[model samples]
Target: MAPGKLVLATHNPGKVVELAELLGPHGLEVVSAGSLGLPEPDETETTFIGNARLKALAAATASGLPAISDDSGLCVDGLGGAPGIYSARWAGPGKDFAVAMARVNDELGDKSRTAHFICALCVAWPDGHSEVVEGRVDGTLVWPPRGGNGFGYDPMFLMDGQAQTYGEMTRAEKEADNHRARAFRQLVALLPARPA
Candidate 1:
């Protein structure tokens, strides 16, 4: 796994930036599938790892290069981990989290606000060989979403024992110990070591 070109199998601008940042220190060149004009495949998988594997393999096969992909979502305890795989769908076609967050609140009513953000990272090679891992950070929901730094449900997620929401924290603060970073830490072993 020498440092080299890698395709990120996602069209999400925020994810592309975040993942690129994470992959930077490894000396790997990162490019989004969307940037490469690769089509997004339907995520028919029921689990995060499954979907991540699907996207990674698709990109790897199409681009004939190593590819990475992640499937992440906010799972609420009260909602029985609903919006789990359908978090994006909950945002509708426009990918509006404001509406999605509102829906979460409405459907939750007075139920527990406990929630967790989970991420599954997958790396696939052109031959279809792959490795996947998952990570999560627990937190609680807050109304009147705060901050505007991160995307999706960040504004509504307050990590355990933290004063600021993920959206309120600086990029360094948010990336320091979030779900994606946690997953990346585990996936790092599969990557080339940082250049000396």
Candidate 2:
């Protein structure tokens, strides 16, 4: 794996912190694109992996350093996978997830609530070499939302057979089996080993 500083290609503070925590133990000095003043690129790609790769490569090329990016969203089966790639956009310009959650519940009235969260992670080097991986977790949507811990649609997502929503679980609990962590586990094999 390439060493030295790595750019986390995201402007979302939640994602930046979450990804930084995952990358920290691997001995990489992590910096976020937002922190570096890198403009957020339009996610024109239709697939999660494609968007992840595009963002990663864009940041890597712009900063002349290796970069990592993730494109993730809730895919509700009832919505015909709507708000999948457009998850963030559903939150509107204010990024208000409450509104997004409400919209989901409103649109999904009396429909099957089966859903899944998918995450696609990409690592790109300044030379444009990149690797991407994806992970997912299935769950059901809940009404009125729940918990106050996690960000985005976490409050309304109850994992299969789990009592608590992602928003109700502690950081350690969420990271243990969430889609993002699942993707990170795969990406870890390609990363440099932890510092001795």
Candidate 3:
């Protein structure tokens, strides 16, 4: 059965809002760790799944509730996936994504702009039971950025066939095919069916 209440292991308001919207229809009430005054744990894991599992497990253990966490990033093929795990760190202390985008543009000068966004999600229970899923969306990078709808690298990521960057798309448009949405769908499928 779906948990009546689930803690989302994150301090990002955008993620909390997006996740809440994605999971709401499943009959779950979502709460963020930040809302409960839970401390953020250091993400020492090297892989996306590992980080997600770490965060989810920490929140579940602390709050005594089932928890979900997502670790997502943009990886550039030409850059050999550097900044993969360090995607957020690229934004620096103030979470300045504008600086991050500039760095990406600087690095890719005159080179292949192929890239992809990846999302790994983990759901953990207080007793240690856990499930993980991953999803990705292939795309190319754009210069000068675009729109202001999405957070992070969305302004520069244009999906394979879409003319608009993720930042230019409406919430519904982006959610329709985003890596996070794909991962969340897989997670929902893996969740135990709600009792009748």
Candidate 4:
């Protein structure tokens, strides 16, 4: 086949940029599902795999193009994985990640403060081919949040073994050590090599 041109199922540009970096040197043409006017999946699935696949398959089938999608969330140890799939809508629509983060801080309030960021990456091909990978970066949650870099849970997540929180870290630092990037690297490694 021709060099792969992937359509990321999500409309989020931040994720689109991150995905491009993770995809690497093959220089594959990356497109967004929003460009195709595709509606985002309902995300009705209970698990990350289900949600990620829903988006990837929908975009791939709609555009007749290979597609990539991610379903990621912050899981709090005390909450027993609550707000997992609902992380995006925890504070209701219009996606107030800031509010959501605050809510988490409030809910956990004075307990064993452990948390993790989980990422599910799904790739779907027009011919119905597909793949899914998962990655997690475990850490403890902090109160009042910190830093000003990352969006959504970044301010509170003290990445494992690191002194600075995710929000405190730069974009490059986040990508190099983030859950999404780890899972993406696995998926990218699986991409077929281009013809010379």
Which candidate comes out best when scored by lDDT? 1
For the record, the alpha-carbon RMSD of candidate 2 to the native fold, in angstroms, is 2.3
Candidate 2 lDDT over 33-89, as tens digits, reads: 998999999999999999999999999999998899999999999999978999999
Q: How much lDDT does each candidate structure score?
A: 0.93, 0.91, 0.92, 0.83
Ranking by lDDT: 1, 3, 2, 4
Clashing pairs in 3: none
Cα displacement (angstroms), candidate 2, residue 166, comes to 0.6
What are the per-model numbers of colliding residue pairs? Answer: 0, 0, 0, 0
TM-score for each model? 0.96, 0.96, 0.97, 0.93
- Local distance difference test, candidate 2: 0.91
Candidate 4 achieves a global lDDT of 0.83
Q: Which of 3 and 4 is ahead in lDDT?
A: 3
Worst 10 residues of 2 by lDDT: 187-196
Per-model C-alpha RMSD:
2.4, 2.3, 1.8, 2.2
Q: How well is each residue in 1-196 modelled by candidate 4, as lDDT tens digits?
A: 2366878899877788888777655566888888878998788888998899989999988998888899999899898887788887896777777789888878887767888899999988877778899999999988878999877778889988999999999999999979998898787777564231
At residue 10, candidate 3 shows an lDDT of 96
Q: Give the TM-score comparing model 2 with the true structure, all chains together.
A: 0.96
